[model samples]
Target chain A: MEDRVKRIEKALDHFLPERKGSLSETVTDAMRYSLLNGGKRVRAVLTLAFCELCGGDEDMAMPFACAVEMVHAYSLIHDDLPCMDNDDMRRGKPSNHKFYGENYALLAGDGLLTKAFETALSSEAFRNVGMERAAYAAAVLARCAGEHGMVGGQCIDLATENRTVSLDELCEKDTGKTANLIMAACMMGCIAAGANETQINAAKEYALHIGLAFQIRDDILDVTGDAKELGKNIGVDAQNARCTYVSILGVEKAQALVDEHTEKALHALDAFDADSTFLHEFAEKLATRSK
Target chain B: MEDRVKRIEKALDHFLPERKGSLSETVTDAMRYSLLNGGKRVRAVLTLAFCELCGGDEDMAMPFACAVEMVHAYSLIHDDLPCMDNDDMRRGKPSNHKFYGENYALLAGDGLLTKAFETALSSEAFRNVGMERAAYAAAVLARCAGEHGMVGGQCIDLATENRTVSLDELCEKDTGKTANLIMAACMMGCIAAGANETQINAAKEYALHIGLAFQIRDDILDVTGDAKELGKNIGVDAQNARCTYVSILGVEKAQALVDEHTEKALHALDAFDADSTFLHEFAEKLATRSK
Candidate 1:
């Protein structure tokens, strides 16, 4: 995992736009600052792992994996804006806006988002994936990141802030906000691997279950996880009056839900005859993680 | 031209997402607010006209045209953000941030940017354009809108704010800040029309010339344009302490430059034997128009 994370970091470094010592220097510097800042690189790992498991080479999926990471980085940057999450720190470091001011942070996010597509389309990784399938993957990634995906979910989350919401509503947000991108990562892997419709659907289902579990555990960790391990301030959701799984279901219940999701996610792997060791362990570790 | 503008507007109406009645309503509403606002759909019209002149069907290029417009609109929204341009009005209406607040405006710009790629990818308008060319066009769009293109230009513009800049510096800014996207539209039109390399290059040169002319005219208007005629504030460039062609070259020299670019633009269209009368007329009108 560390090796793969290092590879992703390296690839992102290679693909991300360089600081051109002009106006681009400001935004690109901020983008590189936030993007290269330490994180687990879970989404990129999933993309590469699923692709490899489905008989695709990591080299073929590396750009897609990095693309997803770029999208993820952009979302985190925007989410931490003073107008959004208003977070001052992330991964134990000052957030983009905190370090670079809101203007640079904002353009940094924009630059990263646009750069993700550039990476996906023109990267050497897609050279093996073929243009048609690459286009398919690009469409999928954009849809997942667009108004109907992360942006849509973000709007709903913002609108529902400070309001008592039903579990279904929160779950809907989870599906749109968290699960969609994860599902896109899994689906992109399958697409790159030339997996058929059945395999793609299976991967999508697995991603949904695991994505929800991941979000629930995130809510739980915000309340119970150590700051050193979590690398962020605890109880932020509660402080913001945000709706979350741990707020709706107590820590114990949320943990149970995470377990249920883990079981379902593992079960969705039945369609695959590969070793599945990494994914099985990944699901379990993510579900019950302290961070 | 009015007929084409109406067609472009209709295409945008079809392609711009409808409210999904969820959290999507908030951001989508904001996107719709800024996108559908009245303006001369010049970029979209140019896309359609160039495509048609290259012997492509209008309906086939409609989505691509609308996609460019969406990209243009998103740039405006972000450029108007208080953290960016700090504008209160656009097209005679309150800016996106003023109407929807900064957060929504931010997300709305984001949503529209992502949607531009999505529209380029999945719109039925690409049915006949082939996935390869469509993917190629998508890559072109993303590249033109990225650090080397719109965002990079914007960063440089922002960095130079309240700073004295030379005519060469100002022109370089204009090329990146404005010419790249226009160049993209013309090149995309050629790609859609299946034009060869020579024709594509010619189209690009034409776009670059006209784009410079168009930008110089915009600078002239910023000084001399009436608030009602321009449908926005006047003398904003001088007020912001920013350098512009009008400021660097003076109004008379700027107008001459516009005329110079206009002549070169028309001459570049010599590569096309097709009826380019509309384009020639369009260039002259755009260069000399009051608003």
Candidate 2:
């Protein structure tokens, strides 16, 4: 991992203590189990990278970085619920439900989602950013996490289960379930950095493109990567009979779409004149990653 | 219902349009279904009343009111999930899961919760109020709804299922699950109305007492009231072996505690001016109600 990503992971660990000895011990435990589980720290790294691209300090973006991770963690937990994807594994270990049981997984997800907002609102750096932008950031996170974004996408994903999905339907599902929060993370980072509306819009465009590319890459990886490489069970999507970008479009077509999105994402970087190297390279790396 | 409450209900209806005209139609429909299931509208009414108490206009409190109800509605929807309470009914009708299916219910709850923050942050009324108070209200609501408050309480409640609980454990559960949001609602109302900290604290105290009293009353009513009046399967707690104050303290003792809490709630109201008649009476009514 990059030093910046490592720093964010360390900060997340420090900031999210177990809340030990509290009534929420179990919830805190489940949240920590998933959050602390080894991952790429991609969202937080992206958040900090975008903030830095806007000349914002990492310290100022810490809470949002943590919040982004919390949101991602919560989504994974919920996505693994019996009524949802019903997966038993994540990150090459037991999923949250596998460890904590289904109900705990649900509550843990709720706790993390709520905690993300609390963290964002209570952070001194966030407060120093002024309420208007903070509120904007908060709203963006909520929209992305909720029905209009991730939740909405998940709902459609469930609706399409065992059913063949057209390419357009699959794209829409990918946009909502996967792309929305990624886009929100980028936009939120910029908003926290006190970027202007134009800058924020550019960041959002970049996020949307990269977010979709990330999903497409995931679809490709599910078909091509080994179970160990992907950190979880392989061909789970096929086992579940779920449609994906790779399912609708062949692997080659999906790869082409990834290229298109990666280019679009880089185009969005053109609007910014700062140290864009990290963000641009990160977008490329995200789209081209094997896992 | 009071005229103001009716007005708020009407406003809630207008706020959530019932239509399925797009690809994301189901999500929008689920949100409307959960949010539009009419309740007492107590939270919104209190917000408006608090705004009025602080010399603010009803219009100024409208968004905050809707936001409160949305949060409340979302909680109920999720709480009714099969993995949670498995409740089939709420407000004397099929629960969100029962009507919309579990997936839709989950997204509906998520949608309502997220839309709530979005509405609060974007409301013209919130902008009219200073950002400080708006942020304060946002923080309070987030905390109340998160682990330390409602969600935490719920976690305990779930853990304690089918276990015999002592009075203290029951109190802790009720405090986290039921009373916390009530207290938050009152505090948010005061903050929205731009009340001083002293007034906010006083309102919180009143809300805390009333909230506990309300739950105790519920426990009492669960044992004593008819199913028709209660609109739920009363004695279901005994059937499920769920720990409740009534099961722990017995009916008469539970009533006595309710009386005590009612007195404390009334005493808390003494700090407020005598002109806050309806708010004070609402507490009394909540304590003494049969259902």
Candidate 3:
């Protein structure tokens, strides 16, 4: 797992736009700063692992892995903006807006998002694999990142702030905000590997279950984890009166929910013919993570 | 020309995301409000016109044309943010941030940008034309809109605020902020039509010239045009101490620069075997427009 994570980190560094000593260098600098910040490369690792499980070369999946990470990083930058969550720090470091000011941070987010597509579409691997598959992967990535997916989820989150939301409503928001990208990552990997429709569907199922589990774990941590370990302020959801799994169900119930989802996620991997021991471990670890 | 503009408008309206009765509906609503707002569809028109010039069916290029317009609209929304230009009005209407609030406006911009790629990549026309061409067009569009292109230009623009810059420096900034998208529009049109390398280069040259002319004309309008005529505030460049062609060389010289670039643009159109009367007229009209 550490080896795979290190590989993703290296690929992400390679995929970032190079500084050309131009006036726009600062925005690129900010983009790199936020993207290369030390964070668990969960989505990227899933992409690579799923691709490998589907009998695709890891190199062929590297670009897609990096692309998802770029989208993730860009979302974080925007989420921390003064107009959004206004977070001062992320992952034990200053938030993008705090380090680069609101203006450059905004541009950096925009840059990273745009670069994500560029990286995926321009990759030689796409040509080698198949243009149709590349287009499909790109379409999925864009759709998951756009209005009906991550952005939509964020809109709901902002609107529901300072108010309690029903469990179903929170689930809907989490599916859009969290599960969509994870689903996209898994689907893109299957597509890249030329996996059959059943295999793709199985990957989607796994991703959905794990995505929910991951979010529930986050909620549990927000209530019970230490800020130092989490690399961010804990109890933020409580302070903001934000609707979350723990807020709605208590930490005990949330933990039970995480276990339920993790079990389902592991079961979904049974559809795969290849060894999924790594994924099983990943899901179990996510369910019981301390931070 | 009016017919072409109408076609582009319809295509943009068609391509916009539909609002389901979901919590994210507000962001989609804001995206529609800003995108469908009455404005001259210059970039879209250029895309369709160039496609036709290359002997391609107009319908085949509609998606790409609308995609460029979407990028243009998203840029304006972000540009008007409080952390950026902070303009309260756009095209005689309240800016997106003013109408939707800064947070929604930001998400709307994000949604639009992501949707742009989705529109281009998922179009049936791309499948018909060839996925390779579609991938190439997507790559160009993404690059022209990303950090080294429009975002980079905006970064330079922000960094140079309240200061005078040299004419060369100003041109570099405008090229990224303005010309890059125009170039992408023209190149995309050529790619959609499967034009040869020479034809693509010709379209690029034409776009570069007109792009510079358009920016110069903008500077002239800011100095001499009426706020009501322009549908926004005039003298903004001067007020912000922006380094523009007019600020550096006076209106007369700026007007001359517009004429020079327009002439060169018209000359570049000679490379096309097809009738370029519409594009020729378009260039001349842009050079002398009051708004």
A best-first ranking of the candidates according to their lDDT comes to: 3, 1, 2
- TM-score attained by model 1: 0.97
Q: What is the DockQ of candidate 3?
A: 0.85
List model 3 lDDT by residue over B60-155, tens digit each.
Answer: 788898889889999999999999999999999999999999999999999999999988987565665777788878888998999889998999
Q: A120-218 in candidate 2: lDDT tens per residue?
A: 777564555776667777778877877668877887787777689898888888889888888778888898888988998998899889988998899
lDDT of each: 0.86, 0.80, 0.89
Q: Which candidate number has the best lDDT?
A: 3
| lDDT per residue as tens, model 2, B181-228 | 887777777887778888888877877777788888887777788887
Q: What is the TM-score of each candidate against the true structure?
A: 0.97, 0.96, 0.98
Q: What is the lDDT of residue B16 in candidate 3?
A: 83
RMSD of each: 1.5, 1.8, 1.4
Q: C-alpha displacement of A23 in model 2, angstroms?
A: 3.3
Clashes of each: 2, 0, 0
Least lDDT summed over 10 consecutive residues: which range in candidate 3 chain B?
B122-131
Retained true contacts (fraction), each candidate: 0.81, 0.69, 0.87
What docking class should model 2 receive? medium
Model 1, A79-184: lDDT tens digits are 8998888899999999999998888888889888988888888847458798777788788899898888889888888888868988888888888789889988
